[model samples]
Target: MESPSDAPASAPSGTTPGLMGPATILPRCATGIEGLDNILEGGIPRGNMVLVAGSVGTGKTTLSLEFLVRGAERGERSLFISVTEASSKLIQNLSTFEFFRRDLIEQGSLVFVDLPVIYDRLGLGEEELTGEEIDILIRTIRDLVRSLGAQRLVLDSLTSVCYRIRKDEQIRDFMLRLGQELNELGCTSLLVSEIGPNPARYSLHGVEEAIVDGVILLWNTRRFGDILRVVQIVKMRGTSHSRAQYVLELTPIGILMAPHLKGGREGGP
Candidate 1:
């Protein structure tokens, strides 16, 4: 069994003999999303906690859902923990995507869980979660992941959960413990962060972005009188990646990306 750690296994030593280079290449969890994998130079390092931050309608949820679907198709158990939306409604919306396969859910490879159910079961009904309550929450999440043998997970709208925690210290501690648990379980996770059109920080508490291993920021920009969706890799640890902004498209088949033409002004959703 993997030991609990705050981050993924450290990169190989520079002096290590290898045909690829000085160090052996790190293992990646391919997202299977068109341009995203390219931007990530294959995909995110396994066991990373990436923040998918964006305003409303920028496709944060769509991108995350696709990640889970692709993982499940690859025989990896995937889980979706919905905080702000109903799983049934999410399934309804997912049906429109051509790449989505309902059979994955039926086969038990993909699972959809509502956060409220966990909260109720744990008796975490207060507006603010106490320190002990937060510990319970983290333990429950870890237990669920372990029970499902999940290799990939998504927490839709992490901002909603942070709102209840309120204090920055607690929020930071929560993320740290939760991330460690997931990393130890070998689960690559995406925590959706809902922000405004132009935000100073990617997360609600401004501390979450610092705790995660990566940040993928999405937004809408106006170019030639048309609003185009844009994606940029603000930060990714444990591996090198392209930080350039790209144009993103949401279609029935799935998301597509192209290099941004530039000269576009930022716009609100």
Candidate 2:
């Protein structure tokens, strides 16, 4: 995890960076989104695993994919761990995004590990994954992360790993272990979660939220019978950020942020 006051990747001043190397500054990866990066104090701290939580259809996948693409554009190795989607279908779905680059996938700058391959071996259903299965799954995940030299990792949804074991205690332990392991690898990570009816809360009713370094909540507020979609940064350890929710839209250009420029002056808490 990055220290609370770690210099932003795009540090504003021209002062020498506090990197360990003699005059060699630390490398920072830029997330492609403009307003989102500003909210992150210039992007998620390098080498920390973050959790993005929301109900189904809450742009979790879209946000994560964009993070991977942003890192790839900056020449940082990236990897996506698909706990639910198939390798082919995963690629097919992301292929529709104009921001997604095929060469990045072909050249190994970005790679995806399909958990279903192992889940099928254990016979776990789509929503059911077991601790025994996860133990087996972790080995494969660890191997792939090393082989690809990935610096950015995304678990499409940690909820699969949570329910696989069928016990909340086991899920908590798994989340802690996963968070610790990801930190040791020095890879920036994002874990997705499916929220419940209480959309205002940041975490699911489990341990995934407790272990993550930061948490982002994607939102859709129904006001005056109108559905307004938004994304907000709820918790980011060691950094200061705007708690307001920014109106969000998905377009051919990519995900758009509606801040003050939109018809609303305020966002979310």
Candidate 3:
């Protein structure tokens, strides 16, 4: 978690301007995650790719699901592309949440795609993704976005894909192409990535941080004999965001985040 003091001054000079200057305010898409929008000064920039990187059990999946579910409630079509979990299992896990609605899925307002199913269809084996394989993956995503007219998208666990790509340059190229495709399709995306415990790096390959428009890091830290979950807006290009870490909680309703208070910690029951 970055301290608020670490953030670049919004008004560095009266004359000299910065990315957060008055003329550079980008359009925002409200995430509907409690306290998160407030921290982001409304929401993430529209059409921007955001990386939700974290270790296991840090609420990355829940957070992404809640984002799609909230968008569905607003009549915005959303697509969830799962690389690790099957669509059935994903839905089953999220079924207990109050925000989860069968009607949304039935209406096709919320759609899910299992990447492994696509992989099998393409006959891709357990090897590094060649240029052709990467192209196939990107095309599949593009076709889904167009067919559904998806306004928001979530790619759950890009870490799985990273494992299949052996080269750093290949991963970087894939991300660049994928980001461009999503932007052109006008879909705001959340790319979930699994990071290792106590990571000095925010992403699996250390390349995603540079490819996306924003990086939101989630992690757990032991404090006073209790494991505390924290959410931090590591970097949000062309947007003003809170640099301080916030305590995150996963409830029956959805995930909630709040500013971390001095000498106190917060977590789910």
Best by lDDT: 1
- Number of the top candidate by TM-score? 1
Candidate 3, 17-69: lDDT as tens digits: 44554655555666878578777775676678999989989999999999899
Query: What residue runs in model 2 are displaced by over 4 Å at the alpha carbon?
Result: 1-28, 120-133, 200-203, 260-269
> What's the TM-score of each model vs. the native?
0.90, 0.81, 0.88
**Ten-residue stretch with the least lDDT total in model 3:** 1-10
Question: Which stretches in model 1 have alpha-carbon errors above 4 Å?
Answer: 1-22, 263-269
Better of 2 and 3 by lDDT: 3
TM-score of 3: 0.88
Evaluated against the true structure, the overall lDDT of model 3 is: 0.82
Evaluation by lDDT, superior candidate among 1 and 2: 1
User: What RMSD does model 2 have?
Assistant: 5.2
Superior candidate under lDDT, 1 versus 3:
1
* Tens digits of per-residue lDDT for model 2, 3-70: 33235444522333235323322333446677677666566666667889877776888888888887
Looking at model 2, the pairs that clash are 129-164, 130-164, 245-268
Q: Is candidate 1 or candidate 2 better by TM-score?
A: 1
Q: What is the lDDT of every predicted structure here?
A: 0.86, 0.71, 0.82
State candidate 2's TM-score: 0.81
